[model samples]
Target: MSRHDFYENIRNSTRLNHFANLVNLAAIDGDIKPIEEKLLKRFSRKFDVSEENYEKILENPASFPVHAINLKTQRLEFLFDLLRIVYVDNKMDEAEEFLIRKYAVGLGFSEEQALVVINKSKKLFENNFSFDFYQHFIESDED
Candidate 1:
């Protein structure tokens, strides 16, 4: 395959893995609420996940492997998306928190970093701020 095509395939695979992670989070509480389902559908569209693949992922999200995002910005973006699903019901449960932490580590965060990020993200989401605001706050410490 061409270099460009190879890169595109990797990008697509990463998106699919991210989408599966979101699905896993949404269903972690034992039931996917209507609001959560709506958000998941929107995310699936954004990720360019076809209906068939979407269904397949929903059936068994854990079957997919986590793809580590190399860029810090992209990793934070993925974490933000996961946080959105967690807060969709207007409350964060223990299962959701644990799953998000696991995802954060899978996204290349150290355990300590994941704890800090997840705690800060919970507070930020409580304020109902935009992703831009969250991104700025999370990356503000960078030189």
Candidate 2:
């Protein structure tokens, strides 16, 4: 396949299949935090992949099997991953934005497309967590 075809595959993969690898790698030094782990688990279930597979991915970062296993749609996910990582600490910084944007360009998005992908990823993450905030709120009300 052409290089374009190759990368396109990466852009279209399900968030679960490949994103687990991305998230896990970023967390190795303790950055994942609990909330991130929750989201990663959700993605794992969503794609029918297991947490076991996630661990495997962590053991071998260089291969990135998700790219070869199924790529027709994940480069976008990868770009979003960078965006998510930038926001992992709860806010975006210039360095994070620049890194994701530059990486997006390499993955084949124009500025506009890259922005859209980034924005969507942001939105996805914004709503990704399913905390028991409501429960906490109700409990607080009891006080």
Measured by lDDT, the strongest candidate is 1
TM-score of each: 0.59, 0.37
* lDDT at 71, model 1: 89
- Model 1: worst 10 consecutive residues (lDDT sum): 82-91
Cα RMSD for predicted model 2: 14.2
Candidate 2: C-alpha lDDT: 0.50
Task: Name the candidate that leads on TM-score.
Answer: 1
For model 2, residues 17-122, the per-residue Cα lDDT tens digits are 3454445344545555665566555545544556677776545544553232133145644544444445555665553454455456556666776665555455
In model 2, the runs with Cα more than 4 Å from the true position are 1-72, 129-143
Model 2: weakest 10-residue lDDT segment is 134-143
State residue 71's C-alpha deviation in candidate 2, in Å. Answer: 5.8
Which digits, one per residue and each the tens of the lDDT, describe model 1 over residues 1-143? 99999999987886787789778766766777887777678767767899999999988876775777788888898888667755665666765576578779888899988888887787688767777899888866642
TM-score between candidate 1 and the true structure: 0.59
